[model samples]
Target: MPTLTKPKEHNRERPVVFMENVSKIYPNGKTAVQNVSLEIEEGEFISFVGPSGCGKSTIFNMISGIIEHSVGKLEILGTTPTLARQQSTDVSFVFQEPTLLPWRSVLDNVMLPLEFRNVTKQEKLEKAHHVLKMVGLSEYTKALPRELSGGMKMRVSIARALVSKPKLLLMDEPFGALDEITRQNLQSELLRIWETEKMTVLFITHNVFEAVYLSTKIAVMTPSPGKVESVVEVPLPFPRNEDFRTSHQFSDIAAKVSQDLKF
Candidate 1:
């Protein structure tokens, strides 16, 4: 059996996200989450792993300011979630689906966020081109959504998310629909991008191996009325590659995360 490792300590001078006794209850009296508190430091890559309907996405929604928490305090970058979203380019979200406009070209889709900002057309194009290149999609700038593979479309979605230069990136199972190989490839690519961009990431996924492979820390939540059951640390160093995936440390960490999810 592999030994379980505790999450590493951080400086904790200031957290990018802070949630204290947070809960989300629907009007119908369904409580999706209860008494959940978590702190994420800047530039950390954190993954949330749990079974379906465990309120993982609910947490994401709360952080993104799409839905307010019913009780307790939630802060993003030291401000209210709503205020953080409206006042700063601090948060971005990538959903399960790419959700790209089929008629729009790759560059256009990536440029969509900048359209709402004060940037000029030339600036938007320049930023879009830069981000697309970062995601290895510069050659597909003119292709429409229909012309690209599922993985390519997701790359475009990620580019769009990065175009705004967010301090926090939230991804909710963005690669859930892709094939295993493609998903693994994107996982590696995302790690590279995360390192290069130096942005904080909160990723949600059902795949235990994926959560273990990509995150510095894994937040394991119990089923419904979800609370964080445990936070597991992956002690493996960064710049992980294919060999890392097959190593004993990787399997051990993945097994520990999987064991935690069983509760």
Candidate 2:
């Protein structure tokens, strides 16, 4: 493991992810993101929330190196996302939909990441099985996507993201399509995984309660030419269970984030 370097006294903990005055503009002169800057502490689960066409997805794409920012710096684990990609740095992404292949079994879908960097078939299967166990889906390894329920399929997606043992996981509304009960269940599952694995997360969501319930801090983004309006820290203790949802502290933080979103 590489020796971790601390930042300054006030910002001493080196950020796992950093965005410095980043901006994105399309050829048609539409500015998607505007001068956004934020630092995400290592192992922190930070969420981005905003309305549609507010550049939330664009910001995610920039962080994932799916597209380059028009200006400023963006870093993941001290390296640009593009550089990290080149080095095969540990980072995984889960999209809104499960997006699993219908023909492939759950184990095969989870093992797909290994195929990208030349991992052997045997090694891929072993790693896939390990992560499947982590997500409580070991029993369904041979099941196809069509065979799983919505929540179960999302669990498979989560397992797939973990198969690579990434240090950072980027999720763009991974549970948006699920029913409320399932979304809440997956939210708790995600927190449990993060607590155990200590992976840094940059999640994008429209749901305020989900943002507060799952994040260490919520980054509120404004609509159009989207930029972070506030970073509200959720002081609630970790290993948070369903009981935390009914707590005053969680409600207060969630309310604050909700207000910020409407601004």
Specify the highest-lDDT model's number.
Answer: 1
lDDT of 1: 0.92
Q: Would you give me the overall lDDT of model 2? A: 0.86
**lDDT of each model, Cα atoms only?**
0.92, 0.86
Candidate 1's residue-wise lDDT over 87-155, tens digit each?
A: 877899999999999999999999999888899999999999999999999899999999999999999
Model 2: per-residue Cα lDDT over 129-178, one tens digit each? 98898888989999999989999999999999998888889999999989
The model with the greatest TM-score is 1
After TM-score superposition, what is the CA distance of residue 99 in candidate 1 from its true location, in Å?
0.5
What's each prediction's TM-score? 0.95, 0.93
| Model 1 stretches with alpha carbons more than 4 Å out | 1-12
Q: Which TM-score value belongs to model 2?
A: 0.93
